[model samples]
Each structure stands twice: as C-alpha cells, then as structure tokens.
Target: MVARSTCQPRRGFCFFMSAKRPQSGLLAGRAPTVSADAYHWRMRYQRIDLNLLVALDVLLAERNVTRAAERMHITQSAMSGVLARLRDHFGDQLLVPVGRTMQLTPRAESLVEPVRDIVLRVDSALGTQPDFDPATAQRHFVVIASDYVSRVMLAEVVRRVAAMAPGLTFDIRPTSEIMLGELEQGRADFLITPAHLTAADHPQEVLFDDTYKVLACLQHPDLAGGVTVEQYRSLGHVVYQNERGINPWFEQWYANQYGSTRRVEVITHSFTLIPRFIVGTRRITTIQTRLANQFAQSLAVQIFDPPMETPRLTEVLQWHRLRETDAAVQWVREQIVAGSHAMPPI
Candidate 1:
C-alpha cells in the first residue's frame, strides 16, 4: 500500500512512501500515515542523481551542447540526452537557441553562480588531502592577474616555485572585468589585483605598493626640463584601457581630480604597449613606478615624477575565503609573499 504526499508539487523529483504488510496482522495491508513534510524531506534527493549537477554546471557554462560535450569528453548525442534530462528535471529549457548561438534561460542564468559554487565545493572537499607535499603532489594552480602584476611579481614566483615543485603547473589568466566573478566561482586559485578592487568578502594581503610615474620618450623636447602640472595637462596622452573599455585606476583618478583636462591621443589595451605608443611621439603616459622602471630597462623611455601627487597603487593577493585553510593554497601564498619581499626596490 502507498500513501500520497499532501505537499505541493515542486520542481525536482518526487517520491512516494510505501508501507509493507506485517505477517498475519490485522493492520497487515493497511498503509501507515507518514508526515508529509518528513517524508518529502527524506525522499527529496533519493530519485535525483547527483552526477547531473556536474553535467548541469558544464552545460550552463558552455551554453552550447556540442561545446559542453567536448568539455565533458562525451559525444554530442550523449550531451543532448543529458540536456533533455536536465530540462525535464528542472521543467525548464536551460539553454535555448538564440539566432546562431545558444542563450541561457533566465532560470539557467540564475543558477550559474550557485551551480559553479556547488561544483567547486564538491571538488575541493574531495580533492584536498590531509597533507600537501608540493615536491611530489601533482597539482595545477590557476591565477588571475593583470599583465603588470604577472611581469613584475607572478613571473618570479612561478620561477621560484618551479625549481622546488617540479610536479606543479600553473595557468595564468589575464585579468578582466569579470575577474572577481571568476574568483568567486573558483575558476581562479589566486587573484592578484589592486587592493581597492578586491572583493570585500575575500581574504587578501598586500603584495606591494607602487607610486605613479610619468613615462615619455627619451627624445621628447617638452619633458627635457621635467614635467609640470600645466605641461602634463597639455601633452598628448597615451592611456591604458582594458579590453572591456574600462579605464585603469590612475586614469579614473586623474579624470576625477582634474576633470577632462588631459587629451587622450592613443588608447591601448596592453600596459606594455603604452610605452611603445609614446615612443617618437610627444605623448606621455602615467604608469606604476615599478612597471615604468621595468620598461625603462629595455625601452627608450624615461620616467619622471608625477606632476601631481597620486595615490599609491597597492597590489594585493586574494583567494576565496573557503580556501583559507587549504594546505596547497596556503603553501603557494607563503611562497608568493616571500617572492614579493625579495623584489628589487623601484
């Protein structure tokens, strides 16, 4: 005999409770009354396969069934079947066709962060070991940082760690507007960014602080006597603009401090390219002193004190709060901190 649940229908799987007959008893065939809430809660996950969560996470990230299948190392038809099952279980088409590409449905979009978080938590829980032996443990770390940070700090950290941990590998991704989102989603093991831009919820430590410096071509006539506030405003500027068309911290600060007084002649996405754009031109750019000093080594650019005082750029290393106690993460953090301390003074 079976008892029906009085609970309202929900989106996920449903289960019914059954009662077995007792041996030769009066109430043998009679079904027992079960608390609807208790039964529902107990059987909630019984019918659902936890593996589908992994599939759903990949499907939602790629949005394209073919691409998702490629990432999951399954055939396209198998991924289609998974998608069909997901749609049926969730009662929604998670990814729908939009013109030539697929677009995430509203429900799917809302689930992106939570699903990624769940998958990451599960991976971390299962993959973490009681002890981390960097020399023998095989691990790949993902770091998200700007080229400036990579050139100035992370490159050295990687070199230093590589000699000690031969089995360890690294994937350094460029910083973007969605960098914090990537960190939150656990795609990045570490995020090196400006202190002010770091997520407030995460644990972060200052890597280093650098003041701004003016960069110009060595042959520039106007800056021969050093730059003045009036000359700085009048000179053509080569500025750094990220791929997302967002201005860097100093550019934003300058605009706020002096309005639109400086004229932007060239805008490039790469910080390393800023000096190249200023060469042979009357243009000047304001960049971090550490990076300016680096470019001065190879490029024919001279660095000068900023015509006006600017806020110091404090680069910071950050990680997900959940990873604070991760042994491997802690080990890497220690190495990075030590590397930062060993950097040459600007």
Candidate 2:
C-alpha cells in the first residue's frame, strides 16, 4: 500500500511506501517505532506548524503576494491568507504597503535572515545527510527499477533495510520513460538500470552482471535440446516495452546484428509477465538468467541458452549526483550492492 502525508516542501517531507511483497529478515511483521528523541521533539513542536516558515521566508524575500504565491505554487489570495496567519502567529504586521509596493516591517526585517537560516538548518537536519543513522531513521526511499530487478532483488533489498531500520519504507516505482526526470527532480532516491540506459551525470556502480537465457513454456514443441538462430528468430516472441511497439534491448541488438527481427506476438510492460504469457504458447522471451531461474521454480517455464552470442547484462545502481554524499542513500546503495553480491549466481 502507498502512504501519503502533506505539508510544504522541506518543512514537512512526505512520501508513499508501496511494498506489496512480504517483508524479509528478522524485522518482518514488527510495527515501526520512533526513537525517544524524535518522540520528544515531536511533542515540543506539537502546536507549531513548520510549513508557515516556508511562506514566511518567501513572503519576506519577495515582499509581494503574487510573487510569493508564484514561488510557492499557491494563489495570491492564499499567500495573503498565509500572511494573515503569520501575522497572528508572530503578532507582527510582517508586511506593510508603501503606496503600490509592499515593504517588510521592522519585525519582518529582523526575521528575514533568521528565517532563511532556520529553514536551511531544518532542511539540512531533515535531509538524508552525511550523518544519517539508519538504525533510528524514519526515512523513505523511492527507487525506480525494472520488473526483473524488482522481482529478483527488491525482496532481498527490503529485507536488509528492514533488518537495520524498521522505520524506513521503500516506494518502488516501475521503470518508465520519465525515470530520469524523477531522479533529477529528487523524487526518486535511486534508479536500478542497465548500463545502456544509464545517464552520464548520475553516479552509478554495477550491481551485478547477468547472462540472458531463452525462456519458454515447458510444453513448447518448437524448442528441443537447444535453439538455433533461425528457430529463435522464427518463433513468436514476447518483449518488454514501456512504450508501445518498442522492443527489449536484446531484440533490438539481435535485429541490428542479423538485419532481421523476431515475430513479436506480445509486447508487455513487465518482464515478469512474460512467463505467464509464454505459457501454452510458442512465444519465447529472452530474460536475465537469474530471473529466468526464479520464474522456472514456480512457473512451467523452460530455460535454454540462446543460439546467438550475447553479452553479459550489467545492471547498475545509480543515484542523482546531488545525493552522492547523503549517508542514508549511500548506505542504501551499499546494502543493495551487497544484496546483489550475496545472491547465488545462476
């Protein structure tokens, strides 16, 4: 399920946690707890709404309701209402109009620099900085990963994270065309992607290198001991495509090398769906060997080495350069890398 909370940016950070899979490790089934220091801090600020600090900073900086509203993505009237609330809260006419222009009052002027400093301090405190502690952190992580990675690795990742920090939650989103935007805008904490899809600026490390295997239903008649290049291209294929009509990386590479293409009988957004789709059909899909082995355990899927030579699939863990120094993010990256290494190779 997804968790949602509301407040202004930086003042009160909010996110959703969607881990449909079972939690792993020793911390499974236990309720998350807040540390005593965090509990006491919450109590001290029980009546204080920190969101107003953001409005105050903007109001003082711009000294114009419309501009401040534009900056805050709120309406001018709403900004005026925030000013009114600030006036009541601070007992000061924070802004005074001098003809057509609004000027900060003496009290507002006094608060201007301090408000900036306080907001900065609070943001630094709330951020996943270099001093982050996973043991007691109430952190939320957003990761964009392919279905294969999510199925083959996310469970283990969650297990490790839960074992260390029960209070942390993960929001794993599917890989999409706009994935880079999510990373650039700080919406996603990390992106698990193949080397071909990696962005230039993001700091990344290879999580694992996997080999591809041809997966088909066990009852497939066309596939016997091994697949030939001709049979592979002639057989109906199920490809993973985030966008309609686009093929998977392997298929594109095959077409480039052989100057021919497979008969794509089905194109689905998820690699996990290929197993179900290929069942009782002649359709064959190329998938990471690790994932193919996983699906073969439950599904009646047969794995085979493809006739054509293929390169090892290197999946990388990438984060926005801005978060490279973040201790929590760094730790999460390390744990994921460790989890990938700990997995038995296929």
- Per-model TM-score on C-alpha atoms: 0.84, 0.66
* lDDT of model 2 at position 332: 82
Tens digits of per-residue lDDT, candidate 2, 1-346, equal 1121232222212211112211111111112244454455446534656667767777887799898776555567777888888899788999998999999999898776556544433443444344657788666678899888988887888987898888778789988888876664445778898899888877799888888999999999877777888888899888787765566577678778876567878878888788889998888988889989998999998999988788778888888664555677667888999988888877
**Local distance difference test scores for all models:** 0.75, 0.71
- Assess the local accuracy of residue 209 in candidate 2 as a C-alpha lDDT between 0 and 100: 81
The sequence of per-residue lDDT tens digits that candidate 1 reaches over residues 251-313 is 889889989999889999888788989889899999999999999999999999987889878
Global Cα lDDT for candidate 1: 0.75
Clashing pairs in 1: none
Model 2 segments more than 4 A misplaced: 1-130
Clashing pairs in 2: none
Output the number of the TM-score-best candidate: 1
| Highest lDDT model number | 1
Q: List the RMSD of every prediction in angstroms.
A: 12.2, 12.2
Give candidate 1's error at residue 172 in angstroms. 1.2
